[model samples]
Target: MADHVRTVLGPVAPDALGRTSIHEHLLTLLDHVAYTPVETPEGRELGEQPVSLATRWYVRQQWVGVRDNLRLDSEAVATAEVARFRAAGGGAIADPTTDGIARDPAALARISRATGVHVVMGAGYYVHRSHPEWLEAASEEEIAERIVRDLQEGAAGTPVRAGFIGEVGCSWPMTDRERKSLRAAGRAQRATGAPLMVHPGRHPDAPAEIVRELDAVGADLSRTTIAHTERTLPSPAAIVELARTGVRPSIDCFGLETAYYPLAPFVRMPNDGGRLAIVEALLDAGLGERTLIAQDICQKHRLTAYGGHGYDHLIRDIPVMLEAAGRGDAVEQLLVANPAAWLAW
Candidate 1:
């Protein structure tokens, strides 16, 4: 079959996917780790506190601990939120909420239908911690079969088939099962001829290590992407090094400007200017075609419904920033052409 972008609605032409976000979560539950006890003030249960203006500061600081800030369960809310993206001329979204992260393929389909935005769902396991206990006993072949099924058939018992093979989660000091998951993703990609994306651990070496893991399985590096490069690959040099492997490095943390990353305090997230600087570095290296970017709006606080920049932030805001930096011509390549080429398997 010719290369086409598989969407929840069905197969679409590559050029049809205009202004796409390569990584996002339309609906998910992080309660697997969010509700865990954290250091709170004097026996106060901060994890259970609902999201509000009063609690937004704490939620921003310790988002993983706040229950309300971690969940995106409302279909109505997702539809409304995505409507903003449609209004801003967004044509597609790749929601890579795979296994271990409460992926609702049915809900994604509904949101796509309501908003008229093409949504490409992901298939595979997430981080080792978010992984199910049954995964420990599962072999790579078994995992690969499941992923293949999701791509060719349907996901989560729904008729909505996954269009891609990841945001496959890997942690720093990759667990045995996580390594197995990467191998499984590689096999699944080989089987289905689908594009793959990976959520690398929060370490500098994590992206390169994952490159080795996938390469060992004979997967197509050019068809694979290393997601969250903004947080994983610290320096522009590190980002360039990973891109040399023929794997697209996705800097998918656009609107998240806080320097203190709650999950990894040691890692200082760059502001928008810093993100553009990295973009310049990639362009300078003649790797702009190999680069991808998104907002990666997984947290509830990152949604416009909750005082956060909606899906439109990238399309609506960033073009002007690029223009100010005298790189306005690259916007089409980054937001439309690159993603369309990558997503079209």
Candidate 2:
């Protein structure tokens, strides 16, 4: 039998995954990894304020520290947002919410059922800091076994099986546990024939270092993605270099336009225009097939309910921009074909 794209609901044909957002988080509780230090008066002020019209602008600027902005846990809000995405022509979403962060398989199933969009849940741990304390002592085999179980059976005690083996977390100066997680992700992908996604560290060198780790485990590099390429790699040339390694380079944070990245202050996050430019550059480099894009909307501030672009930014605005640049043909490739190919098992 042909391989299928496993989703929260069940198996879907790869081609059935329509204009897909390659990376997203319908529900997230990243405050554990992103809460602001309430030491100074300014810090305390930002920490306490809820995400609102008055706070949204500043929250966008200083996204990481604000506790309210880091969370995106509303199932009702997610359904509404995803419904808008479907109305705007989105057909599927790849949500790599795994361990560490809050991965709600039950909520994802409900969202998919409500909106009729394919929801691809991820399996594996996140950053070392967000990982469950007991995970530190788990062997690589144990980790891979859990990932495989999530893929083959059900995730988080629900019947929603994971479609992929990542957004596997790796940080700059990678920890031993993170390395073990990468190897386990590789093993899971090998066992189940699912694609692997990775959230690389802030360092520019992180993507390549991660590729080395995955490569060591004999993972299918072509089926692996080094996500957050726009933030993690310095320039289009650097991203192209990583793409040459046979792993897809995903510019997953499309709607986020901020110079001040609170997570990695030194690294400059690209605006939408700059992100499109990177996409064009990838197309120019003949690496279009290896490119993936999404909003990676994990924050409350980025949701339309909170006055941000919501899930349809890629579908609503990006094609117009790409067409204006004379790469009109690239729109379908970016939003539909590329993701479909990458998402397939």
Which candidate number has the best lDDT? 2
- Tens digits of per-residue lDDT, candidate 1, 1-345, equal 789999998999999988989988899887775454467662158778787887777777677778778888889989998999999999999999887888888778888999999999999988987887888999999999999999988987888899998889898889899999999999898777799999898899898899888888888999999998988877888888889889999988998877878788888889888899998899989999999999888788888878888889999999999999999999999999999999998
Per residue, candidate 2 scores C-alpha lDDT tens digits across 1-345 of 787888899998989988999898999999988686546888788778899988777788878768888888789999999999999989999999887799999999999999999999999988988898878889998999999999889987888799898889998889999999889899887777789999999998898898888888878999999989988888988998899999999988998888778788788888989898888889999999999999889999889999999999889899999999999999889998999898887
As for candidate 1, its clashing pairs are none
Q: What is candidate 1's TM-score against the reference?
A: 0.97
Task: Please state every model's RMSD to the true fold in angstroms.
Answer: 1.4, 1.1
CA shift at 116, candidate 1, in angstroms?
0.4
Per-prediction TM-score, please? 0.97, 0.98
